[model samples]
Target: MTSITKRKTFLILTSLVSAIAILLLSLKPDTAIMDDQTLYEKLNNGNTIYYLVVGDSIGRGAGAESRRDSWYAQLERLIKKRYGADMQGQHISQSGATAFEGLYKLKNTELIYPADIIFLVFGENDRKYMEPEEFAKHYELLVREAKVRAPKAEIITFIESPLAVQEFANQIQAVSSHYGATAIDMRKAYRQSGAEVKSLNRDQVHPNGKGYELYAKTILQTLDEFPNRKAPSTKEALYVQEDAPLHVTTSIETQQGFLYKEPYWTTGKKGSSIRYKVQGNTIGAIIKRNPNGGMVDVFIDRRYYRTINTNWPLVKERYIIIAAGIESGSHQIEFITNDHGHRFNGLDEKPFQLAGVISATINSKGTAE
Candidate 1:
């Protein structure tokens, strides 16, 4: 080939390589807004509703002065102003949390348990370390975990900044589809007639405040009906039988997290009337359903607090732990309802114990109850 032609070809190859490299680097997961360890700490108790939004710097609101103006913050403000004061929420966006970081931060931090709603915006960072296929794998894992941890929480995947372009969008679609999450096309919203977001981007990717204003408007519009609906009901089917022991009556409107079934796990039919006999601290034999002939384990801090031998029936004072599983700090405990059933095999936790009983004697950072 001619020397001139060879030189031209080399130039083209170098330019292509550079562009591809730039695209990958821009998509790196570490570049996300925040990860679990990256705490925004904007927790306020004014609202009864809570949301956990995760993703890159945009999700973290790097462009905003105090991280509060970031899109997530703006969303919170809108919710509080428009919805009411009882809509408290949190933003856990890290400045550079990639998709991988999201899995760790979300799962380890236990946000899923408390989160009534979730806005997951990611993928820009995953582009660097993985192909769309690989990103999809990890993304699926994250979704599965979310399902297990936050069964009631509705997850919405805010499509990554569309300004970054199509390749990323396609990856997001594939991954979101594999995981059964809602894929909100932020790109389409940003490009809508009234928004000037494309022009307000600080970089071709990140946007300035004006840019976020457009983003926020689009998000708020979608979220307008979010708070109006009731939280999800339990998907697990509950069966109560004549001889059924340990039956907990869960209301149809239960939210997706921990539920407390009360001191007597077994709940009798409302008309039948459950009776308990107290023998001092230990519960004496009593009957609710048919007759329990197994040992039901109770939880203290989720670690075997006590056990009840159903050799007889319900005993009021039976195995009520003195001081209720002494917790020295903020702690959690739960018990399985089926543990008392002869053939129960659903749910990891049916009832949970709160800090209602703690006192200075139990928790160092708390008062004695």
Candidate 2:
């Protein structure tokens, strides 16, 4: 072989290698280019960090023996030890909350302060009743609301449970990417841990203490990888209107056959009803759920909407979404008690109770009624 021919082959191979490197770099997701030591140094600046957690049962630290054993609690403790920073956590999570419920709660509740970090720990309960698309819509709305409330906060979405489907996790990743947020898939960490996933869980659904430790470890490792990641600015274009109007009705209605019970209006007799006039595309209610709870038929603008059963195994207050995606305009919503012969612990004539009503418009202009 001639010297020129050998030199030409080497040049071609060098060019091919350069092209492969460029392609790999382009395909990689944008990540913070800092070492662990530098990241820890930045975090250990002695500044107080506020963390806002919003989601379902896992976010509320359910199934853990104590609050200290929960994932977030452990994460805070580890962050204090490793980063030498003080952390405060605020939780707005419910045990059986879905994405819709989470959104409703976020809308109704006021933030005490702007958060430094926001952890969205949903998907387990959402996957049980919501399709991937529906979950994405609600999740995106939740993220939008979080951004508006804390414009500079770092948003992190968690795919925390093994029971959550891949499709749900995919949607979470897609939405997070679109919003410049981060999605941490704990399933990957669980798989890499080489531990039996089922054994980590306390029961069929909730995780045990060891499982929560894994969750904290996974979150910390993921954060270390992207220490300088920023959440999307609220000034940027958002899927949801930042100033969307939400109307809440807490006043008692003067209706026949209904007894005012401090916070709620209770009626055991069938056909008893309460009405509220609200203007929005979405309607929800804060109601009481118990084993003796009965059925309530909903009416929108005097038209029959849907029947909601208020029965639960235990007595608790819940935000129940009555209807969504309706036309934006003034509408009268009525809930009529329709208790059939449903027996709970041999008790007949279940009662229906209403605490408050809420309505929200997506992008329409309206004032609270």
Candidate 3:
């Protein structure tokens, strides 16, 4: 009960509290990126900036504790802040996806969302497996494909550290130059920025938290060189399902076809036919695959486009392209079940199983600024 005793206890408690606060601060990110209120304002008052990030595990944040802590996430935050826009981040980077697979994946996203800016971070998986020349060609194809899919989108090819040696980096540079895309060498950036070696994750292939922070910083700094495009005052997005009113079909059945959490999947009979009228340059489908599935033919505007096989041993959800690089106006997409020469006889009952459809309805007012 003595004054000195009470004062000593209070002092000890205050010291502990101070230490705890410092520890907590150290555990948090170095600086506050953005708050919910700021993000809401950006989504409402600002323009719409659709940002797409594609690549392998590196871009997928394999080494980071949380994916939101990745470089792309950080860059997106800064982009929204600087441009004052509703920057929608579309990340299609899978862990094991290579350049070739990435291309197909990109093709799969044509109608889901049209990106305004695209960041391609690949090459880690292709290090020892593919030749530099071949990889470069494939990289070029990917860039060209992105250009064809979203002509107005800015394509950026980002090369990461340690593994991006001279030969590999040169290939990437060649591809970027050929396609008129920008390539950022993170290794050079890290060195010039004076980041430490500890930024590398314990595995050394991927990056740690600090490394991702530096990565974001380097990318943001590079992007600063380009002028920010003036987006529309108001933006709109649309996602349509196959069974929606837009579809005019005879054979395709709209019912609970798959186990996934979806609205409806268009199950195809032997002679099933489904059609959708969409208003966009790009078109794609959300499909489900199973061992009992078959092939389906796709047609764009009455022209035979391509045939997609929906047969797989395992069941999974997939995004498939119906059409891209078409004129932005009223268009029709038709799907017909083409089940023939079946290796698995069990698929005779159920043939084509398509999940949904998606499209981003861009304004016809004017081109993206």
**Which one is best on lDDT?**
2
What are the lDDT scores of the predictions, listed in order? 0.48, 0.76, 0.62
Candidate 3 per-residue lDDT, tens place, 222-325, comes to: 66675444321211111111111122122232222222224434454555677666666546676666677788888877799888777766565655445444
Can you write out model 1's per-residue Cα lDDT over 1-369, one digit (the tens) per residue? 999999999999999999999998877754342122111121222334557776666777666545565676677677677655344456656544565556545655655336656777777766654455445544555555566666656677777664264666776676556555567787777666455664657776776677676677776676653443332333221111111111112222212233335542342111111211111111112112223334444444446555444332321122122222133343333333333333233423212222122111111112233
Backbone N/Cα/C clashes per model: 34, 0, 0
Q: RMSD in angstroms, all models?
A: 23.4, 17.4, 14.2
350: Cα error in model 1, Å: 48
- Which window of 10 residues has the lowest lDDT sum in candidate 1? 237-246
Q: Between the candidate structures 1 and 3, which one is better when assessed by lDDT? A: 3
* lDDT per residue as tens, model 2, 188-303: 87788898978788987888899899999888877667665455575442334434555788764446568877688888788888888887877889888877888889899889
Where is model 3 poorest over a 10-residue stretch in terms of lDDT? 236-245
Per-residue error (Å), model 3, residue 145: 0.9
Window of ten residues with lowest summed lDDT in model 2: 30-39
lDDT for residue 49 in candidate 3, whole number 0-100 = 61
Candidate 3 Cα outliers beyond 4 Å, as residue runs? 1-46, 200-202, 228-369
Error of 3 at 248 (Å): 28
Question: Per-residue lDDT for 313 in model 2?
Answer: 76
